[model samples]
Target chain A: MAPNGVNGSSGSHRFDPDFTRLVVENMGPNVAPRTRQLLGGLIRHIHDFAREVELTNDEWMAGVHFINSIGQCSTSIRNEAHRVSDILGLESLVDEIAHKLVVEGDVEPTSSSILGPFWSPNAPFRDLGSSIIQDPNPKGRVALMHGTITDLLTGKPIPGAVFDIWQASANGKYDFQDPENQTPNNLRGKFRADENGKYWFYCYHPTAYSLPTDGPAYKLLQLMERHPMRPAHIHIMVTHPDYRGCTTQLYPKDDPWLATDTVFAVKNDLVVDFKPKEGDPKATLDLEYNVILPPKDYKGKL
Target chain B: MAPNGVNGSSGSHRFDPDFTRLVVENMGPNVAPRTRQLLGGLIRHIHDFAREVELTNDEWMAGVHFINSIGQCSTSIRNEAHRVSDILGLESLVDEIAHKLVVEGDVEPTSSSILGPFWSPNAPFRDLGSSIIQDPNPKGRVALMHGTITDLLTGKPIPGAVFDIWQASANGKYDFQDPENQTPNNLRGKFRADENGKYWFYCYHPTAYSLPTDGPAYKLLQLMERHPMRPAHIHIMVTHPDYRGCTTQLYPKDDPWLATDTVFAVKNDLVVDFKPKEGDPKATLDLEYNVILPPKDYKGKL
Candidate 1:
């Protein structure tokens, strides 16, 4: 007898409709259930896409060549695949799906956003309220950013929540992208909330910037006639030993590209105002935001 | 006022249901009409797939990394992207869709098949009845393959139709794959039909072979619990000046893997019998087949 899940006996496979079924059936029996489901869905959808387009052989070969060129263009410093995902807005879509809030009782979870490609694991640890900007003569407006991490269920501060933050400089470049002047760990830092769950940092206000357009990603954008600009934003990942972690971005209100972020990462709840300081000349701007975390006992969607 | 195909005002673009539309709208104005249709369909389907799967951020990242790895593994000699397409049976699907016969006025077209990856443009030109096998003491059964190229409309022989043929050795390896022993262009030749539309050549009977399993394509098959073997077949491309070219393969009728060709390239019409030579002891087997071509004026779905 034929094995379970095998579409038909070996002799019965045909090209019309059975070909797809045969391809799916031939998948290894040992594949994990989730993997099987994902692969099956992917294959089915891909086949449907091909059929819907009535994809010609020349078009198929063109796609193959395009993918190969994407591969050829990738390197240690340049990730063409990641750029492709960004250009397609798939990364943001995945983020949105993966981080849906599941409310329990009265708890309200903080919104999550895209953890963009600029994140580095080596951000320096700094004291709360310390300046993250190391450059003495920075070109952008200085901002004081303050926030508190609290447990949504208990409505109490999470005293020791750690915040990993990074953002682009005034000239719209990350530290690694501008090695000529910016020192290591510039505009990136790790800090812990105080006993009152308060955290603050001084940094330059991030400026909106265009994505790298020299590679396949840019080529795609050019083909799409789409602008590659990302709105001004600061990235942060908040984590606590007892609560679920959150990776998000704080978009500045009124940014021209806010609605048209090339990566499609903006969320209304994640937008914040970067208000100009009223009295302090030294502080060019101030931002007050808060983060709410799910409790350790919470068992809901991330 | 917005441009012709722009979905909305610049500031109105959002990430909810509108994101997909924005992406489709942003496609460059100069894109060919067909390309726009294809890309638009692709973006919609990809977005739909992500939504259907509820693709997680981690899963998305994993896919990105996987694609990058496939790219990194590609070289001048190996195309991992094409291998992935083959393993997914995408290549065969494209072939099926692309080579559909567009019949006109009782014209019968030759069956088309997948163009397997081993074909090289460097096959040496040889006269009709030439021996493609250069290995003096080849260890496989010697076979005499003869074919006729005819016009589908007239059913008359089309003289001077060029045929490019290639196949693996009995050891299930191609000349390029067994460079340590096999000479360049072994079992590969370019021949033309005579005035009577007859062509013949001698070669070893091909053996079923496994695809290269060290790459991502094989890894996927292994995960799917599928074998990577392609059925024994001879690759052929016949082209006449007045006809549309035909790229196809002739599968042995009794090959064990014919029913389960790893690439799903097998079709009943493309299968031919490899009969044992009745009287000639020198020729172990013989294959007689004919090819039909559509006139250049014939234009249909394919």
Candidate 2:
């Protein structure tokens, strides 16, 4: 029989008596209620995992050392812990849980997606429809993208919504990754919607890219015999005074890796077509998308 | 309905569809069978815990940053990750699982305990019955501890058994912790058993001590309103050519924190009395203990 509070209807295994007690009652009296709850569940699950596998001492030590190495590998330029989480699908999982659709009456909130590891707070704000690809020797077809932001419940345009947009170049490199070839803030821009709640930008077509392979995250991927590619996509974050902020990504519909993105951030609703344009001399492709945001007064559990 | 391959009889919670798929099918084709099994259960439990609490994005980010800080806090002299595991009761749990008692034909094995974080591999060797407390101004009552190592199955002396012993000073400090006052290897010694499996050592009585409070581990303790004291005990590791190695600790019977040791390393069978001696010229107290070891051929699951 399983020990009391060990399995506790959340697992189907028995544990040593002392371990069970430690997991069930180790919390101190002064811990906040929410902290207590979070820790209790975390402890139980970790203990259960150990028991389920009958983990050896050497294995446990290896895990300890692995965590230490990850710490040692981190620097201001790289976050190995975040990379580990991304490869393990934890970041995507957290995003899905924290940003579930908010329903107020009959309105549907915009779909949420991964913030990924490349977001920068210093993206330069630009005028509407300005070219974000400032490099003299750009490598991809030019595209015109436009989007509008609206309040979900009121169906009214949220004028002056700020849109922060960024993506990899056609060569699958972000600005930071190719400092010698790409100017600072290349392929990254922040634009404000006009009085009609519509915003537009000119940039090169984004492409699929593999994560850095020299790091521990990619090493794990190699060990698992898995790919490191994220799908062709563009990232966008919209914010307005009267609405809750929305951070999301837009994937090309025809990208072969859409269903198998290593980060698991893709959703069917977030995929769009990059259609060919006929009448623009400076742009070869055009795409249109719209976003809906929850009202600031929305009171709903996430 | 619960998703397939997720919490399938092991847990009692529902998960987001994508999260469930990631937990169930995230392993790659090249992953070892054992690794796949371990990771499957681990992913499932982590997801369940997140869903159970509706973990917020801020909380998730906080956890990520906390882990990174633990990594950054580590050094050659300190392992903050290990310290975190120790305070969370994970080290004790792993010890209990890895060092289970071994029972052979008609023989009961000796009880095992934690090796703790203070052990050093550079202890000096000494003759039988040597005084380990070489400090000229020792601060506590002197004690003589003697023990015999015998084969559990036959109750016969195990010749040439080596005993490695260490303990904190009466002032509740280890040699390394007070280098300004204590010699390099004070209070640490190794001795070999006689033909009769007998060994003895002289040392000062140990007192309960608190862990370092300035690091992240103790900061967590403070936040949880928990004390950081470990019960008074002497650490020992016994090894013989014809028997498996045993690492354990012996606790005094009268320690105030015996039942509430912060590390939870105390076992009922490992606690002993420290009796006062009437006329010991070199000692004020005496304690006698015995250890039983399984034969070299003993085979048991841990």
Candidate 3:
């Protein structure tokens, strides 16, 4: 109408590709550089998608409704939008790309992963070699997890490096997920590295677990006919005053879900072996992982 | 990580563009054809945008927060999300593309426009030649609007074609928006076509008005340094059982906002001259427009 106005608005299902430019130009001129770049990219791509698909009016309205539902379903305790991002591998991809520069020469720093919804603030502090297994082996085999924290640049152990560790039980449930059987801090602990930067603790052998199945993300996965299982792994957040903190996850080498991790977060360097503990009274498996931290002041080449 | 898994997750801010294919692939096999096409297009475009911009974690998070705030602010009374869509000119684009095929032979049907948030059902049914100007001329000039409805294919006047019309007062405020100064349903009415398909009514001359200035859409306009005024116009909805309904707005040719209508909805055929009426006591301006309707079952070539 109005001779297609300013953008050659036409009477066809397909939009003129240059309409993207018109949309960007209409944003006026007060925008900051970064905002302009981001908004411009989004406008071009979104319009491209709509045009490529030849999205009908009903489909566009449906998409809008889906977005509104995601907002309605999201809350502080259950961030449905974040869950959607995770399921789509957006969060994982972003974290990986953001932290990719944390390397010293050819040696890459420990790859960070999604901090899944199970983590809580202020984990219970424990001794260097104390166990995080507050509950008796009520559901699965006992495991001893040990690791060393080192500087990615110096390739040397960092003593007194503070780290937080938490994982789901062998039954595939976190402490909070199974309130009746697990103790308050079961399989969750905070520890400091010893003189040699070694830290060990006892916990349950991890197992794959299903994400919440009640939200829109779950419904989307169902539509895709995809499962919602995350691979068995231990969550780690290691830090020191001289190093940049790294929040990563360690996936056992042979976990079935690793190849199809629902979150797409299994980095090769983060996979480790879980050997059998030879002669321990309270442990059955020995799980070992090592963490590498970047210098606090490190900046990648621009 | 993990040899890029199935999609080749890489370590660059510019994501491996093919990762979009991988993201779409992960959607499994149960999706309907239409859903798959839509999702695939969206995944491809969204990923392309992220990669093209080399989006940072901070920027992504800011976008997520903005989406959450939009959901929180949206309601039946004030749909901030729709407001955002309107500001971005998305609604206009979709509506234009959807109605582009309503043509017969060489004649294009009346273009459809957005059903803006102010529309209400159950308007007072008035005589075809009566006045919709229930309130006194307390703001601006009185106007006489007259039009004929005809079938695009037959080129014959359509008798008994039902139509609804509404507009803001000369003060640029709708009746509901300015309750103290305007009577209920002032400048709003439902009317039927006469034997000759002619319709006429007296109402206030329409004028420009600003959109709500307190929402995120308003704030975004502030960031873009763009004005929020909409051009002077009257809303019209014409319908008949044997023809497709058309919802459109008429923009006066000389309105200052026509060149840069905030919503980008001015079609050339929808703009008309608001001429000065001669020797008329009840009206000063004369507004005339013709409506065209397509057959209800008409379908475009696939």
**Model 2 docking tier (incorrect/acceptable/medium/high):** acceptable
Each model's TM-score, in the order given?
0.88, 0.90, 0.85
Q: Which structure among the candidates has the greatest TM-score?
A: 2
Model 1 residue runs over 4 Å out of place are A1-15, A102-108, A153-156, A296-302, B1-16, B102-108, B122-124, B299-302
Docking class of 1: acceptable
State the interface C-alpha RMSD of candidate 1: 7.2
| Model 3 stretches with alpha carbons more than 4 Å out | A1-18, A102-106, A117-121, A134-137, A151-154, A168-186, A241-244, A253-256, A294-302, B1-14, B102-108, B134-137, B153-155, B169-186, B241-244, B294-302
**Candidate of highest lDDT:** 1
For model 2, the stretches where C-alpha displacement exceeds 4 angstroms are A1-14, A102-108, A153-156, A176-178, A182-184, A297-302, B1-15, B102-108, B176-178, B299-302
Which is the winner by TM-score between candidate 2 and candidate 3? 2
Q: What C-alpha lDDT, on a 0 to 100 scale, does residue A297 get in candidate 3?
A: 88
lDDT of 2 by residue, A222-275 (tens): 656678888899999999888889889999899988867877788777999898
Candidate 3 residue lDDT tens string, B1-302: 01112211232343444455666788777789888877766665555556556667877677766666666667756677777777776777677667767343778888888878677686898996789888875667787888999988888999999889988887788888889988888888988999998888887678888888877778777766778989999999999999988998999888998877777777789898888999988899998888998878887443
Q: Note the chain A TM-score of all models in turn.
A: 0.90, 0.90, 0.88
> The CA-based lDDT of model 2 is what?
0.78
Q: What is the DockQ for all candidates, taken in turn? A: 0.37, 0.43, 0.34
Identify the candidate with maximal DockQ.
Answer: 2
Model 1 agreement with the true structure over A1-302: per-residue lDDT tens digits: 11112211122112266767777877766889878877776776566557656788788877777787787788887888988988787887788666666675665688888887789999988998788888644578888999899987888999989999998888898888889868989899999999999999898777899988787788878767778899999999999989989999988888999877888888887889888787866678999989999876686643
Candidate 3 local lDDT, residue A227 = 90
Better of 1 and 3 by TM-score: 1
